[model samples]
Target: MNLYNLNPKYRILVTGGAGFIGSNLCESLLANGNTVVCLDNFATGKKSNVTPFLSNKKFTLIDGDIRNLSDCHKACEKVDYVLHQAALGSVPRSMNDPITSNDVNVTGFLNMLVAARDAKVKRFVYAASSSTYGDSKNMPKIEDVIGKPLSPYAITKYVNELYADVFSKTYGLETIGLRYFNVFGRRQDPAGAYAAVIPKFVMQLMNHESPHVNGDGSFSRDFTYIDNVIQMNIKSLVTNNTLAVNTVYNVAYGKRTSLNELLDLLKEYLTEFDLKIGSVKTTYGPIRKGDVPHSLASIEKAKELVGYNPEYNIREGLREAVQWYWNNLK
Candidate 1:
């Protein structure tokens, strides 16, 4: 049974729709008979990521940046909903250049919000981050309780939540903020300074090179799969529960996996393709600046409110993702 059947077809606008998560969302929505408009400047997003969708009659690509209010306004024209995913990611990158990060993540976010409000979209769902729980020593992070942001990137995301709340209250715009925890899956880029751990490690192991562990490998995260995130976004879009609107939810698998455990699982999966990969070792490095020691989300609120039932845990997601990289990128 298609769980998304309850929702009516919508003309959705996905900012940063050429990026990893946005591209996946556009693909799913288009598959389900919805019209999708993708707005991207291609700063961090690649044109190749969206090339496959160009022929789709339902997909429209807008070559524009969110930093420009007119561009955001143009993208929001007649759109039913907005899934704002475009932003400069990576704490280290933000630390190095806080100005650009603030411009794209903060100012750009505000532009999207104003556009959505003017367009009168049914709902505005934006990607928040687990880094919002920065510096908090909590084991399982709850949505309501968050620690002060430790980095400029974290600060920008936290500010997004604040802005969303204010917009919902002041402008009567329906909004939902999803604080994603370590999302990884297909189309996730593996070649970048700020590449995510799963794809980065998979690429390294495939090349028979030693993967670098940022810490003792004991640091853990509640890694959520991209499909699960897509589900949450869909649910947020269609949920009739008024309580679910105008609130934030932690989108995660509700389980924690250490970096060491993750590497071991990667080896197990990739070794089936090439047995020599099993012998590849990992090199340890100093802990990264602005990195949280541990992260685990309490998804009780998401489940009770938005009916979020994640379909994949870490191992299941990794199996699918590893196979994707092996077949496509390797």
Candidate 2:
């Protein structure tokens, strides 16, 4: 186990701090006695996500856009570290509106990097996606080997890492990227058209509707839980390991769960609430473009470097997530 020498009086900045993962990060930091400044434009983020933190004296909210350099500058002021989570996610959505996605995910990310560099932030940690591993057939993907990006969203995330590396070499800014794989949990909005699978499935089950499975339902993914992601962010902020700096890590459970098995599991868990909900008849659609058949992460590097240990598998994480949606969202 690796121990981080964290500063007790650090003030950290979290961009997109009102979104699902960002909100959780903010909450965890405040609980640990750190002062947190959250910058969010609420583009995809909701105000309610950060409402609970308003009462915390250690928490400060900055309503701003990352695309605006001034807003990024203002947010980074006096911050020790930055956890950049702001981005336009989803492959299909990006395929639909590539230009807007590029503006927010690419240009906006660059803006944050420049601001963080100028502010001399200790480290700029940003969210890079496993989508960057596009077209790579290698199982348990290693960071060193990646294929060409398959979508506009993938292109944007890949660009974030590319720019981070360039900035580190050029301006001497410390940066780390976490390549997140199918992250799911509470506050993940299920109402949107481009909602993630877990929340969307849970919502559909709550509505007593048949969940649609794209492709043959054999498509697998390394579905990571939110709490694990929270751990990675905290570790990235405080780790003083020289070898750990200016690199990327895979934030995942290092296990793959298939869609067919996932649907069955969802039905099984939801059945506890309503026994009438038996085997759900799922509708299969054509395989979506830019989606790989399976995704699994080789987390040895993260484990060795920053002591990244994932505590939840898909079933355990989904069980908790389903219960949350049932009690709060239903």
Q: lDDT winner among the candidates?
A: 1
For each candidate, the alpha-carbon lDDT, in order, equals: 0.94, 0.90
Candidate 2: residue 118 lDDT (0-100):
92
Q: What is the lDDT of candidate 2?
A: 0.90
Clash number by candidate, in order: 0, 0
Q: In model 1, which runs have C-alpha deviations exceeding 4 angstroms?
A: 1-3, 6-8
Candidate 1 C-alpha lDDT tens digits along 2-102: 43763436799999999999999988888887889999999888899899999999999999999999999999999999999999999999999999999
Alpha-carbon RMSD, each predicted model: 1.0, 1.8
TM-score of each: 0.98, 0.97
**lDDT (10s digit) by residue, model 2, range 1-330:** 222445557899989999999998888788777889999999899999999999989899999999999999999999999999999889999999999999999999999999999999989999999999999989889999999899999999999999999999999999999999999998999988899999999888778788888899999999999988988877887777889988999999999999988888888898899875665578899999888889999999999998888889898999999898889997
Highest-TM-score candidate: 1
**Residue 188 displacement (Å), model 2:** 0.9
Cα lDDT for residue 3, candidate 1: 36
